[model samples]
Target chain A: MKNKLLFSLITFTTLFIMSCKQDLNDLSNETNNASNVKLVGLGIMEISYDMKTIRDYETDFSILSELDLSSVNPSEEKQHVEMVLLESGQLNLTITELNFDKKINIPHEILPDDSPKIMKTEIIGNTANFYDINGKLLGSENIPIPNHRETVDKIKEIGNKFSAEDINKTIATMQGYQFIDNLEEFIRNAPANGVQVLEQGENYVSLRMSFNKIDPRIQGASVLLIDKSINKMVGTRIYDAQDNLVQSVFFGYNKGDVQSLSAIRIEQQTHLPSGSEVKMISISQIENLKFNLNIK
Target chain B: MKNTIFKLVSFFVLFLFAQNILAQRNVAWVHGLDGDAGSWQHYNAIFDAERNINSLRTSYNTDNGITHASNQVKNSMDTFYGSNANNPLNLGIGHSMGGLMIRDVDRLTPSTNKRFGGYVTVTSPNYGAPIANSLMDGSVQNAAANACNKLNDGPLSEIFSLPYGITANLTTNVLCNKFISNDLVQDMIGTPITNYDLRVGSPTIEALKNHTNNSNIPRISIWAQESSPVHWRMFSSSEFNNDQTLVNYVNDAREIYNVFFMLNTSLAMACGVGGFWFPPCWAASALYTYRATQWYKGRSWIDDSENIWNSLIKTTRSEQQTYWAYIWIPCSYPPSLVEEKNPNPNCGQWEWREFTRWVSVNYPSDGLLPKYTQELQNIPTGNRYYVPGANHLEVRNMSNSTLNGQPNDVTKARFNEIFNRPQGDWFRTN
Candidate 1:
């Protein structure tokens, strides 16, 4: 009986080895088949990415592109928001209750000729932070937060009315959390239940409110990385209400060397509120953006 | 019997030394005129292979005279040769005017080891950079400003204006400051980039003059692409590009994107325009710091002059696990390169084809080319072609696409596949 079992095992091993060899051969053959053609394109191939840091709502955030967002963190829900600072005389974005829905003519210029265009978002929690034209804190709010809801519900409401697409993943949500702990307390710590800031350039401000306790589910910071030039968001990072920093990441760029091109800074925390996560918003959307550099 | 033994040992040692020469490629970097040895930082990062380095760095004061430049070169040679008491040296590289300096070294030093393994020029003007014509004035900033102004159709008000407008306003009968700083610029010029080309390269081209006909010395140009100046407002032109293609790369938008200073943090600090943290200069500093951190901060062993020299500094040689090792920069024409207002029509735009023409013209003249040609000549010539469609910057720096997705015309994995592939000058040569 032992001999028979040994014989069977040997046969199985031989088959396995043969299969592995065949797989490698196939892979090599495929590589060879494509070797004759140009393996590269006119430019460097773009890789996707995710949010590197928690973004503040008021400030315009542009950490990663769509390809970069997808390369770093692949998720459907995480995405970036495109925004622009409308030039109403000067820079201005007022959060009103649809006072003039009939072509209000809000003019914004994100790129040189306004390519990506500004997107308007009015999802404020009760007493949430608000920003002015320059992205500074207007005043903490304790009043009614308008249009704040879960992403899914928000998608459904806008979908039936105005072809709203689900913003699952983007540069904004490069740092996203599917689940976390200690959630309820985070909202309560804001100086006025929320803060607001001015426009997006030459005057934008960011604010941080804390909570005594938070659900680990609430990862990263409450700040949203906004695309002020484009007037959109790339991601939303949620931090623990109590702990100052579990870990934070920011967008990276190179200083004209051939060594490293892009890098994210990950700062570790020594304290509690462990396992914080971040979600990029509209990171997937950055791809749709075409710049109006006004160059030939 | 004792004599035989001694001879045998000597032969063995010689054999080992010869093996060392063939076993690994030796790459030495020479600096540009009036450049710091520190500028080799990027090269050090790109070619991490084990080899002795001879840093021929001089300061802004290096422009003092030919004697100073020559002394600096001699001192550099002494320092490099002194450092490596053992092992044979091969390969040589230079950036900008440093290219001319290396040629001088090749002419002066005929040591067997100095035969060199290869040669590379980054954004060097084999003939002469157009700006050098009027750059007789000794200041780099002034030359740069004059160049920008000429490109802008008039003397530019600031070095940091948009290229098109700057040039347009200058050309159509307005804002011409051509003569404003022309006199100050008169005494400010130094070695013309192509002066050696005229003095040396012309003779070599005339005679097809590469000594030894050693094809082992190959020339590689790494070109840094267009986006560099967006963040680095007043930095010079050659520097903005990859010193003219010795190690190709582009500016990383993630860090250098002016939006951070113009819109994002710019707005955040509008009211605090002059304070240290929020001051405009501080914001610029922040952008600069961000740029430094993006490429050189923790990535390489060398310091890529990102900060003003602080006498007190810390050095760490610990390894950093870089996810994306190499990225080829995409080729793009910078608007500034082809301004209609450019005064020197002869100054060629930074084009790959133009660069190739310059290389071909200087092929016989470059001293460092023989080393590379000799190293590769015996390999039967299947190589010697540029990676197709590869961005110039990607080969020198790790790809941004994979470096957490800054932006790209290519992917990180692909860049890595090309990047991490092994390359060396180890082919057997007769």
Candidate 2:
């Protein structure tokens, strides 16, 4: 009787422990309830602004005349206006500073050499005025420079905080950022400073370009560096059996910097949005050139 | 009473013989890079205890590439079972580089009437790892110090001075130079060899690309994928990827055509986020919110390209064009780091803790392999099976082990199906 009772007790203890262990395991799985949750689909949108070239404005600045003037403060001595014009045209502008009011008709003419002449605007005291090359007044406007002293102080503080090296680093990073963010737009609109036929293969034309970087509206002023120093250009362009341009790729490197060559294999695939018709060439690298592909 | 006892003993002996016959599908286990024969002991124990099946372990210093290890696997198998064994051995199971070894053996060995069973590869880097880049140059120092501690013999300087010596062999063995050579095994101890290149057309990479597994042999790929614990790192691109709900139109507008998702179903726990809350959110706030800030943005062009490629490129391939009928088994949990072994026991404990903390801060890896690299896409036969709360090591280690209180042995049922399925019905869905 003693032996039987001892055996029974052992069995009961084992059963109890096993049950407890099972319960604990179930509880743990319950706590980590990732599989139970429904996947929430998310939508992401990207915004990028590309400034028009002088050629763009000269082609048609009629789009500039469509600017909304409702927000302009008539009482303010100086005001700032920023516009992205698709096309340009002539328009009347009036500037009133204290008692003096200046008015002039402005013709939106853009330069072909991709110069900063398109970004020019002048304002003085109560009467702000702009003129053509013939010394004739074209336009005048009254605008308020809000918290002008504070703006000046802020600019001075920034200058103090960032050294020349720091500014250059910031610019370099921004340039890389712009190249990645607006790659297609940059390639389409960018004025190729210099494009030369580097190599002419049997069916392909390799074109090298001295690519120029653009200057956008910095705060309220368009800051364009007028330095015409050239950088070496290198790139490749592939052609098909019919001599049609299949793909083109290029990059500009600063002097003394290491030159790197990259290539992407273009496989035939369907169009993205429509999913109909095969695309002969696909461009995968729009961001950084430093990359690798794992095959097999 | 004596007669009854004798009868029972006879029955038990007969039962053992019968079991041996039934469990004819013996397993030949292969370990990953830098692993020893004892590495798969825990797994072997599981096979013995649960299935009553005996398995042979491949005893090779796993420093050599998969091609070299294939010869070791064949010798080990042949030695364990004589040239003409009455009972046939069929199944092969591998972990990481071990998976490649098995594939190479199967490919090189001519097919016969007595062909083996299919293969199961756990967390194998069939495609190269991006983490390999971190191993190049002096960049290895930038990786987690805890991981570095595992590579060093004594002081860290010893490994640095003589990179290709004992220390380099140990760590270089783990790097799997065939898959990647960019950075991982950066400085070899004493050799003039600075660059280990695994670029296309390189010997090992080219060989790997050329080799393809047979269609008859089925392949089961088990890999881990875990959500990053560094979600609350306020302004980083990682944080932005983690918490899509946190919206700032100004910042959101800049994020183009990308949506990142965590592998596991459970939201990262509040306690996990608590680690970043130190100094009441010093690094966390900056990492999460700051990257989204225009001036401080950190961008990965590779990730950007992946997004565009996934959307634009059609991912369809023919069966004949691909190898490995891969069934991807997903492991959802924090991955395990190195097995604790140090001169000082306390050092091992410290390494584990620090490594765990490091993984929680960085990308969600299988402790050793990243989830992105672990995932294999575009195989026609590829299917997914989800296993939550199981890390890289736990899947192959002892069954009794647990990660975050969830039992690692949950995969036993799947293993049973793979191992004990009726002959020639291994590929059947049921």
TM value for model 1: 0.28
Clashes of each: 184, 46
Worst 10 residues of 1 chain A by lDDT: A108-117
What is candidate 1's lDDT per residue for B364-392, written digit by digit as tens? 11111111221222323332322211222
After the best TM-score superposition of candidate 2, give how far the Cα of residue A143 lies from its true spot, in angstroms.
56
Candidate 1: CAPRI quality band = incorrect
* Stretches of candidate 1 exceeding 4 Å from the true structure: A1-296, B1-26, B42-75, B82-89, B108-117, B134-216, B227-430
Residue B410 CA displacement from its true place in model 2, Å: 4.3
User: What are the DockQ scores of the candidates, in order?
Assistant: 0.01, 0.01
lDDT of 1: 0.26
Q: Please identify model 2 stretches exceeding 4 Å from their true place.
A: A1-296, B1-23, B84-89, B113-115, B133-210, B229-367, B370-386, B398-405, B408-413, B420-424, B427-430
lDDT of 2 by residue, A89-166 (tens): 111111111122331111111111111111223322222244333334434333221112221232233345445454
- Candidate 2 docking band: incorrect
TM-score of chain B of 1: 0.37
